[model samples]
Target: MSFAFTSRRLTTLALATAALGLASAAQADNKNLPVASDGTMPSLVVTSTVPGGAFAGHNKRGVALDAEAEFPASRLTAAEQAVFAATFKPKMAPYASAAEALDPESVINSDRRFRVYPQESGYPYRAVGLLTFNQGSGSFSCTAWLISNNTVATAGHCVHSGGSTGVWSTNVVFYPARNGGLSPYGSCTATRLHSVTGWTSSANPEYDYGAARLNCTVGNTTGWLGRAWTTASQVGVPIGIFGYPGDKLSGTQWGGAGAVAVSEARKTRYPIDTAGGQSGAPVVQADGTGPGTCQGDCGIAIHAYAASGGNNSGTRITQAVNNNLQTWINQP
Candidate 1:
């Protein structure tokens, strides 16, 4: 299928803001500029075909997590290793706040995360999984979740290296509710990748969110998470992050919940614990309150970075983001 933004491009932000009454006149005006000029950009969509097949062969059912062996060490090339290292730069500190600080006992050895087992047993959890892909000269992994029958939302960095010199990723695959090597709902490969020019061309964290259109309709069986955006402050709102973390057993889903510590125009920060592989995980409302347009189990941000300054952060789902996601979700 050809990849391109839908008819709703230029006026999407305007209409969304007006309908939701979420942003002020100044905020809406600033968001309407072209992305390279430090404003929102149109979504960039790319299409690719899985060379061999779309379905990953590993569909072992009723497999025990403990019985599976650990994944082998990554065989990244020197150049790829350097690129991976750059992602860890603590350029920004966590959002400073008294509530953002956690008690030592509140976190177990500085990690408050817990594993989610029988991943396919329920909503939200079953929709999230490990996202493994090949970029440059190495293979890497991140987290992703379904938003539509064939669309999986993820971090922009997971799909492209970012910036003027970056390249789009290859051999992308999504393993929904994967427990160790057991793919309860099977696996699917990406046929299309979508992000914004702000991220693909400028590597801006404000736009560091992306989505993939799968070759299979696995989300129908797994169910998908609802998404929402608001101009209202998100501080103190209870939220959760669920995804496959590399710090734990391979393919294991670990998650945690905490109050939103900081809310920026394009970012949201929290005291939640997350590791490298958890990037692109959904940051959803934990209080079961579905704000404007949220159907339930609604995601408000795409978890993207580890604790900087103080709290972990992600790309907040703003008006422009919601517009692009709505378009992507309805793509044929």
Candidate 2:
């Protein structure tokens, strides 16, 4: 909503991971999905034979056009073909063709890894980005995060823009701060969206942990946060939660303070001092262990966010529980 305390009476929804069509969930260890094509459409898996033959449609981005559209497929020379190939190659893995592999260095390091905790002066891990949404209004906002390989964690509310479909609706975006917070990760379709069974059913904001799956890569980069498991839920632990809060670049960047917090009462609690844009963030414990459950992230309960001491408390939602969410990604 426009304000945090107003408490918008909106119903939260859940999406299974498979709906995203991602390679693997739960660290099933599948590789990253293929990179999207030049066109805005999701990348299609075309065989080498198809590129020069059957491929005949131009995707929305117009970059992944049919080979027939490349002009003369036969009269083209090797050098000419090489130049064309570099322009329209597709695949998420490191390039297989030398033509497309021109900028290997930049492509490889494109995804910047970041740590959430051990808050020193310059922990480059914390990332903050605008969470563009359309929740009944046209205004824009932001969210922050700690990376886990193109994967970021923040609150559900930040991404839930408005209705359920179309542009500027629910399923907001996260743009990791690179290039001085200027460039943005291309908007990915919400392949899968979800939240804990408990939170959506009830009206608890602390347990309001919801996550959305992106079919497109932001920044064409990578970032990942290890999922916290139920096996390790500790209270009174220091954790970090990063996101692009309402503030600006000059102010507290990287979603502000990532001090430690207690993890009592796993669910039905969240005492972090962040506003709306900090939902669904991955909370990391200071010990560097699993249970990376922290506030500003959502979906499954792992550990609540209480004060450093034991005075306060909140819910603990982690990918560990949400990890299984892949099972329900596309039930239909």
The top-ranked prediction according to lDDT is 1
lDDT of each residue in 194-248, candidate 1, tens digit only:
7766777777667778888788777666667766667777888888989876667
> Highest TM-score, which number?
1
Provide TM-scores for the models. 0.70, 0.45
State the lDDT of candidate 2 residue by residue for 1-332, as single tens digits.
01010001112232232334222322332221211112122221111101011111112454421111111112234566345333321111111124222221120222222323211322233233334444443434444343322333444333332122312225344444422322322333344444432333332334434444544433223233333334344544445545433222211234332333334333423334443233344454433333442222222232222222222222353322333332222221
Report how far off residue 161 is in candidate 1 (Å).
0.5
lDDT of each prediction vs. the true structure?
0.64, 0.31
Candidate 1 TM-score, true structure as reference: 0.70
lDDT of 2 at 219: 20
Q: What value of lDDT does candidate 1 attain over all alpha carbons?
A: 0.64
Kindly state the number of residue pairs that clash in model 1: 6
